[model samples]
Target: MTFEREFFYDEVRDGFYIPGIIKRFWAYELTILSEIDRICKKYNIPYYADGGTLLGAVRDGQFIAWDDDIDIMMLRKDYNRFAQIAQKELPEELSFNSLEVNQDCEELAASVGKQVVGFAAELLRKYHEYPYAGSVDIFIVDELEKDPEVEEHRSLLLRRILFLIEAIEKHGKSKAVLKEINEIEKIMKIQFDQRTALKPQLRRVMDKIFQEFNGREGDQLAIMQFYAFLGNCKYPRSALDKSKWTPFCGMQLPIPEDYDAVLRAEYGDYHKKVKGGGGHGYPCLKKYENKLKTLMKGTWDPDYHFSEEDLVRPKIQNFRDIAISMAEAFKLSHKQLFEDCLKGDISTCISRLSRMQEEAIAFGTAIEQKKGEGTESVRVLEEYCDALYQAYNALSDLTALKEDGIEKQKQTEEICRSTDISSGLQKELEKIANTLLYYPEKLQTALKKDFKRQVVFLPHSMKYFESIRPIVDAVLKAEDMECKIIPIPYFDKYGDGSPKEMHYEGDAFPKEYKITDYRTYDFASELPDCIVINSSYDEFNQVWSVAPSFYSKEMKKYTNKLIYIPWFVTDEINPHAKEDEKAFINMEYYVTVPGLFHSDLTIVQSEEMKKAYLAKIEEFAGKDVAKKMEKKIAGAGSCLLGEKEGEGIQNVVDCFRLFLEK
Candidate 1:
């Protein structure tokens, strides 16, 4: 089957744009997904979209805008059965890669199906004009013992074995690496001949560890070897025991029966549209694009020998390259450390910081060891090292305070236990310690000083602009807040892949409001503190749609908060009244659209309207999500009605001020 999708350049994450090449890469991945779906149907092997792919399916009804790969999981038993028959069932264009199928493969997880051969090659050439191979990552969900301690031990052993496998592949079975592997194997109680390939040997040990708890009765299951250290990766066995079909792209794909619980467990606030780059860097096909093209042309050699430098780089590189690498590593590590801290994973944060310290020291020593470097270069390197150390010291202090906070929380719990307070009162005290003391203090410590937060307004049309004008005016007058009104372009989408015509509604906006040109304003770099949007239909609107780049989900990544202000206000409709209930039910199409679903906060016209919106959301998203949306959906009173009545405008202003302060 031919898989062709329209490709477009858009901002996929904050400061990260998806080039046309990445879109083509996504098309390649979609082809692989389709093939997998076909084989699974034919064989009756079960699979559910895993990780980011599942998040995308549930949230966007397709691939995550920034994601570069598709991930699916099968139970260990089903996975083994699929692995046995996938190659035979798959079309000529696709080839499944696993240790059993390709022993040289170094991946800990098996099954990178669809390597862009035969039909897939011709399809890409015909549609995308670029023949690039893409694969669906197949993860195995293995059963875990109910005991937390035993599960933890298994996870640790699996991680160590996986690490050694990676080290062997990268360092070529060096004595140091092999020594580490030997120790891990002894602990795993698996031994192998010295002449056997180190990579496959370690993988076998991992497989043994993974299968140890399989077939035994257990209530927990985990996606093996992928983020195994994360406490939330394990799930209740019931979460995946049954499956239901959900619309993904254009196909119905199996999802966990308890998808909501699974998503919530994996991502604390799964509904919130927070855009960030995936583990693999942006434009994931860059390294393989040329190689695939050459392979398609029959010039690529399958078994090319590597030069000495290719096998392993020198211990010390040129000063410039070393400095750049160190800086990049520090940035990535620092970002990850803060993310772990925010997730309340203090141990992971500390462990990452310790690794960063070691890396910093190594870099500093390498700089010192470099010979014939100019005095100026030496001075700069020394200065850089000093700054790095100072930053590390500050982070160390912050982590210590976080640890102290945890101690204080534990002490508070103990005090409550010792007292005559009711259980409810004890719970209240614990909550106070966590919300009022711990999180706020940690955030305060990390807050940067003397920076003006950017608040951007993206109003697609003149009518929508009027809906949010009051809030925009309030933000402009607020001190220490920078406001930019960037009116975006929309389109009249035909049912086909292309739009009928592009519309620039910004031209109709009042001339008094400062409008930044959509072409010039950089959403990624500005990284607005808050992004206010009036339109949210995205591609769902057949008549009039905002450009894909301006979708609320896309904007959510560039800003800390994506605030949605409804373009129209309705009179209060009491759900209790039959006529009003019917009216409210009919309004579901407007109330439960993507814009509101993806927004961080949505301000409705009045308290009555907020209830109406919540009722519709509950009907579709379930009661639990509706409960969470209570905080997200606010009643600010209509800006349009407020202006006409000339009284409730202050309420709108007050609401905007409260959100901005947070």
Candidate 2:
């Protein structure tokens, strides 16, 4: 069977992106910008190239070649003056794309200005179907007052204007492309006739429509600032204090001097060489050596647009914004607790509070099972429960108790309260403080021992889930072990329908997001005796928890196995054990086979990868089991796909096919 495939760009009638168009369009954008700057300087208009365009220029002395738009800002007063000058001075081919009268044309224009002319030229030349346009964006920057209330009012108005323009652009008002062009021509004609020397004041007024639209209530200014900082700069890790004074786009934009230190804390080495590419013709710029290329695909192009339908789009919400949203959502949900009035409802709240408290106690029990505090996050959770209980009880009793009321109210209060309002809730809070507490530890213990006996190799995404039947059949056939190979739903992230099913796909992922050294390992405990993890430079310690001390301690505690597998490491250079490293720790006994070929019973994915891995094992283990196992490996080393020695060998596909063939 043959598969019919096509590149992503092929699907679009006139894909806005076509590789080289970025650079060419950027050059034209820059040239137009230079002209703007020249005119601004002559008239003393305070302006600065801002946002993504500014970021690209300052960071690398070039445009963010992947980005498809350019942004520049002018003081609101200067912007008003420049609007007048733009109409009279700009060449016929070049003009300001107002966010008003010609919103559609302006949207099209902004989209074009962001594209590199050369890249667009190449696409037009090659495919002869790509659309072309020319444009630039002018952001009017008003001096925001220090007061949040005033800033909020102004921001609401600005956002409303933006929404109207976007709506007009996305859903064209005209019926046809020709009709839209004619509309633009009429607008320009009206503007030209109104002015004697052609000042853009009329067009500028047309851009700002003060219509009667209810203003949205939210911290719009803060939201705008957050995105501006996140999308435009390499933010400092901690407080972002340094970002306040640093230069942006050749202007003294705000940034703190200690910004470099904060950046290093989060993205270590801030200047590492990084390899980049993801399907497209050119390599995208990367700040770190192993920055995920997968997440970066198609985000910078003009044509590849994804919708942001939610009122608060997660795709764009910054860390602070997320926190605020979460807090609000939680508050709103909590209001349901107070919406009803009854002694019974209060009891329900008491039960919930009790459960949370019980969970906290259980956490303590689990900590005792482990050698030490497993993770700091667990400890913080324990503290959160304690605080929550204190708050809940105080509130519950103050409202529930009614000493001044008659006998009936007094009896109801005593059931949930102690002698006083505070003590009653406090006693209840103490009783049920330890529910799902050490569950993770129990899971860890089970994983190390009982779970290791049965293991299955799972892809990031599962295609043929039923394919696991043969493997189960083989295991049962070999060891009299009646088992199952669970088929997990795989999300085919790379175009295909490959599922990304992993045993720990849901709850097991770290609750809090952080860049740390602890790595998470997956593979259901009951499925296998041990798991082989793939690693990268600094990511291994953080992403998979493969440190020698952690591995050995875990191995000793549960008698269940937590094996270390190294990829990209060779046996010859530091084979067996390096003198400086711990004996049990350095590369031996961890049982790693290269991803490609394993001379041992291990199956490698490719001949080339196998050859490289085998050479290293031979150099280190010398004439040991690694060598003996190499010869025993049957049917080309490529068959294993890096499965352990003595285990069954089957192609990823063959594993599924065997059940059918049977």
Root-mean-square deviation of every model:
30.3, 30.9
Write candidate 2's Cα lDDT for 1-662 as tens digits. Answer: 11111121101011111232233334345556656766676786665445545554445543443354566654345566776676556544455655432423433112112222222444333322222344567654322244556645644544443444444457644355335334444644532332231123322433332211113422111113222223222222232222343332333333224535433433355454222222232222111112322334643222111111201111222222232333343344334333321223455555555654575566445544432455443454466566557746654664554567567456755655444434544444433232323433433443233212333332211222222333434554543222323222211111111122222232232333121222333322222332222221111111122223223222223222222222222222222323212211222222332221221133333443344345444544444534554643323322222364433335533432332222
Per-candidate TM-score against the hidden true structure: 0.44, 0.26
Largest TM-score belongs to which candidate? 1
**Shift in Å, residue 182, candidate 2:** 30
Q: List the global CA lDDT of all models.
A: 0.65, 0.35
Clash counts for all predictions: 1, 68
- Give the range of the ten consecutive residues with the poorest summed lDDT in model 1: 304-313
Q: State, as a TM-score between 0 and 1, how close model 1 is to the true structure.
A: 0.44
Alpha-carbon shift of residue 344 in model 1 (angstroms): 96
